[model samples]
Target: MSSAIAQLLDGKALSQRIQTHLIQQIQQLEPQKGRPPGLAVLMVGDNPASAAYVRNKERACTNVGIASFGKHFPTKTTQAELEQTIQALNEDDRVDGILVQLPLPPHLDAVALLNQIHPDKDADGLHPVNMGRLLRGEPGLRSCTPAGVMWMLQEYGINPKGKHAVVVGRSILVGKPQSLMLLEANATVTIAHSQTADLAAITRTADILIPAVGRPGLITADMVKPGAAVIDVGMNRVTEPDGKSRLVGDVDYDSVQAIAGYLTPVPGGVGPMTVAMLLKNTIESYERRI
Candidate 1:
């Protein structure tokens, strides 16, 4: 007997659709003589991952006709300097969205810098105002990864309403925000983290399981409920047998796929959707201004 294979959620293609839509909106906004929609990306330090992520965002901005303004601060930059940069971007009429890449230097106060961005221009959606809006069910830009995860579920026709959703990892970016979004969709949401006991037992009860924990292969086959839709948001790089590194998610893809009704692959799933949604948010910000 052959094992059932799970259907893949193609984030790359979905992102293309979002980018195309943004392009059309940008064309419509071009006739205006005033400031065009702009995204200011703040990179603090030389982290390879952050740099790569910023480059991808810049490329997405170009593809969607949004102007990109970038500020690179040395790793030794003071928190005040970062705050000043954000304030400048906030006051810049041409700038519509501001993103501060994560894993900032130890000396820098990430939250303080993030809070300095104008609430409306907080594209990464990490500001307290935006987070509050999400909690209150008020319309605002959501955290990119969580927003992408929700879009993936919606695009795949997996309505969370009345479903049991278990989200592992309670980080503000992915888990907590995602749980809120799921709750907004009327899903019974449970958030489990590193401290949660009997993690497998909690996960097995989920109709929709989302794992954003950075740990590789945290969610195994036994933890996955049969026919559940699993979205693995982790992208940890691990060395393979041949000694080359490969991107792997929290869920053990090979083991979980056999039991899952649908699954999103690492590197090709939530990652692409993030930038895509950023463009969407930028365009939406422009529309709101108009």
Candidate 2:
């Protein structure tokens, strides 16, 4: 095969297109419904990264005419207080979607707080009910990142059916649900984690490779099949020799791009799609209410 740089999946462009469409849909519905769709994002502490992410989500909501019911809590916020807040949002008719920012304060029980959200308002789709629906291939809100990956594949006409897909990382947030989605698309799926031995051997056999582990340079060029589609879901910030930090993915993009047939860029790939999917989920919940 002639070697060439891999084609980009271009999640950023696709996300923008999806958002534009969503804006029109919401506008047409808001006139009759009397209020725009609403999303409640609850964040705790002052993690710089989490703060930046919350801001992005809220900004996206504003851009699409969705109401933002964002609540920011101090680092010392208690689990009981957060639970009560979720209970309140659950009862609020104005709120259609509720999301609790991850990496909450140590004293707070994140899972318990998430469980308190009504399944219909679980905007992040991390609630157990939604996950179960995904496993059974039923209609329900889906986990945002995994759903975004599936949408990207469909947008590019990358059919996973009858292909071997190897997913690195088994976290519930991305890896596990991603594997399930791939399976639903008829791809033969293999999940590799820290305990898995001979990781490169498994990856090399894949027609589609997804590396979600947040380690820089984990998947080298040699580990990829020459013509495989490589989706890099890992987002890591590493300092350069000059002490300046920059974002990178799990795959070594420079080397892998030459070997792989298709590849996703670090910052512009899955990140924007995740946000786009979040907005989509919120609007879906809103539609259910009306």
Give me the candidate number with maximum TM-score.
2
Model 1 is weakest, by summed lDDT over 10 consecutive residues, at 28-37
Per-residue lDDT of candidate 1, residues 66-156 (tens digit): 8999888888888877887888888987888999999998887788888888889988888899999999999998899999999999999
C-alpha displacement of 117 in model 2, angstroms? Answer: 1.1
lDDT of 2 by residue, 19-111 (tens): 999999998888778899999999999998899999999999999989999999999988888899999999998899999999887888888
- What RMSD does model 1 have? 1.2
Give each model's whole-structure lDDT.
0.90, 0.94
Clashing pairs in 1: none
Clashes of each: 0, 0
The most accurate candidate by lDDT is 2
Clashing pairs in 2: none
